[model samples]
Target: MTFEFEDRKHENTQLPNNLSAPNPGHTHQLISIMNTQKRDRFELLSAYLDGEVTATERRQVEEWLDKDVETQRLYSRLLNLRSNFQSLPVPSAQPVEQTIGQVFGKIDKRRRHRSVAWGGAAIAAMVVAALSSVVPGRQVWQMANVNNSAASEPLYVALNTPVVEIPDTVLAPAHKSAPAQPAKLHQQNN
Candidate 1:
């Protein structure tokens, strides 16, 4: 099979209606130039709106706006935007005391939450420490009485253990107990 490559440069040269297509390079350059001019014009108009332009510059912008319908519409929109911004309600100043109180309240709330979390963590650590120190297969009371003497040993009563009563003679102290009494003072006469 034979293949042929068509020339794109001459494609737009000959048209049925004899109309010439614009050059791609010229079209792009024209567009860029127009955009630059439009940007400069808008800047001038903005400066005019802000009352920063001289009398001559203001006149030039006025003339350009009067001649171009698009520019006039753009300027009208800019004016409307400015007026809308100006008409917006200005926020009133809040009382300094109330603002300070609100700020402190927020700070205090955060501090309280942090303190509560820290307290919980401390309690958890203590519980872990206590459990780790206890010997395996031993009651928590036994751990408490580890340092106590045999005579004053802790009670080993279970949950289901029956209560037993001892006679008064066994319950009494082994040694003689002294009765507590108030002392009387005797006055001496000279």
Candidate 2:
């Protein structure tokens, strides 16, 4: 059951001691307090139903149930629900030892399958590695045995720039005490 702000506000309209109506800000505080009270009351009732409540709390719940028709109906429904749950069949459980043995058996079976799968993968990898190395080695060997007649032709490289010899002194590194002079070279520019 829920109490809306409007319903609480209506209840406040009939306050004793000629109390004034709550201001807009105070209205929110009242609503929160009402919600908290309702939640606490329900928790107390649950504790009462579970036989976990102290005598005082039990009395409080009884009084609350007596005064509040909604609470009474709620308590009745909770009682019926609890009874239905208690009346349901309880499922039997297997022995703990047997259950544990089954779990370990399954784990061992999976481990065997995983080991076989990993072994097959390792063998496949070795085969692939052997094939890769053998193919490359054979190709290299075949290349080495090819005719050398094509390789006997003299190899030469040509450049467009004319070669000019500079004296070794001009190319030599100068002492740090005397600053180095740049080399002057003759060139034909295209």
Candidate 3:
């Protein structure tokens, strides 16, 4: 098989030989084994390296490795890679309270700003409500007292009636209707 190098920098450096066997005589046999193709080769090798492979499969890989130089080179490369990773520097830990307080400060600032905005909105609403109540020819605006249980039913009835439709139907009757008769109440003796 012919080898091709696309990058000039990688031209001289020996690549990780992923080849299963190095022997020239067995090259055709190895190629046939590779081409027959079912499961992944790397996965099989990884399982073998981890000692998770069956005894028969282990024996097959061992026999193949015995006649292989490229497989030996790959094994050395994997060993060096593992060793290099193990030698890497680890990052230092930061204090938990410092991290929490920094995030908490931003949240607190946003909350304070929102509270101030809502307070201003509430004050504006109160001023408009007061002015509307005090204006001449305007009906006296009454808020139902929360402590008065008697007003609760009326409030619910009023809420159930659509405000816009009430003006056309209530207060002033149609000119065609005669004077309304009052309902007579009867008392029952207990």
Candidate 4:
């Protein structure tokens, strides 16, 4: 049975003409190769549209576009896309001087705010120091008065002393060597 099957297979393999039939595997391989080449051409055309291709590359892409209608269509689509982008409006650029001035102005404003904050802190510290000194001094004075009645009494006597009125003739000479005239004193009671 194996010998008969081999004989039939050999007979079926022979064709009437010298031409060979196309293999399905080979056809699939060729299709894949063509697809790869088309992809490469599309990439080349994209680069040409972007102005990234060299002169030699430009000529190659042009030649490919001329040879293949599909490549030519792709190139036209990319050109249209580029033109659309170029037609869009763009914002105007600011002058360098104006931009720098604005940046400096913001920096100066921030610095002023920081300085004001520091000034407020300094004022608060000064108030605290003044209060601290005055409170301690008053406490010490009160303590001294409580400990010594004689010392405290003298302080009151000095404050309540009567004002004495002296005549202008007593202060007439500006020079120390000049003779001084004696002036009568009048005491005013408080």
Which prediction has the highest TM-score against the true structure?
A: 1
> Which candidate has the top score in lDDT?
2
Q: How many clashes would you count in candidate 4?
A: 0
For residues 1-190, what per-residue lDDT tens digits would candidate 3 score against the true structure?
Answer: 0111112223433323544468775677656555433123344455667677766667755775687676666666766877898899887777999889999999999999999999999999999988987789966758886766776655434567666575656577677776445442222322
lDDT of 2 by residue, 1-190 (tens): 1233224324543334322365776677667766866766676777778887666667767887889998898899889989999999999998999999999999999999999999999999999988877784365434447788989998765476436655658665665455434442223221
Candidate 4 residue 46 Cα shift, in angstroms, is: 2.3
Please identify model 4 stretches exceeding 4 Å from their true place. Answer: 1-43, 50-77, 123-190
Consecutive 10-residue window with the lowest summed lDDT within model 2:
1-10
Off by over 4 Å in 3: 1-39, 92-95, 102-190
Candidate 1 lDDT by residue in tens digits, 1-190: 0011122212332232322357776666666656756666677777779987766677777887889998898899899999999999999999999999999999999999999999999999999988877759764544344544775966787567447755668656768766544342222221
- Position 54, candidate 2: lDDT: 65
The whole-model lDDT of each prediction reads 0.71, 0.71, 0.62, 0.69
Q: Rank the candidates by lDDT, best first.
A: 2, 1, 4, 3
Clashes, model 2: 0
Q: What is the lDDT of residue 129 in candidate 4?
A: 81
Q: Write the per-residue lDDT of candidate 4 for residues 27-94, one digit (tens) a residue.
A: 66666656755666676677777777766677777887779788888888888998999999998999
Runs in model 2 deviating more than 4 A are 1-24, 53-59, 130-190
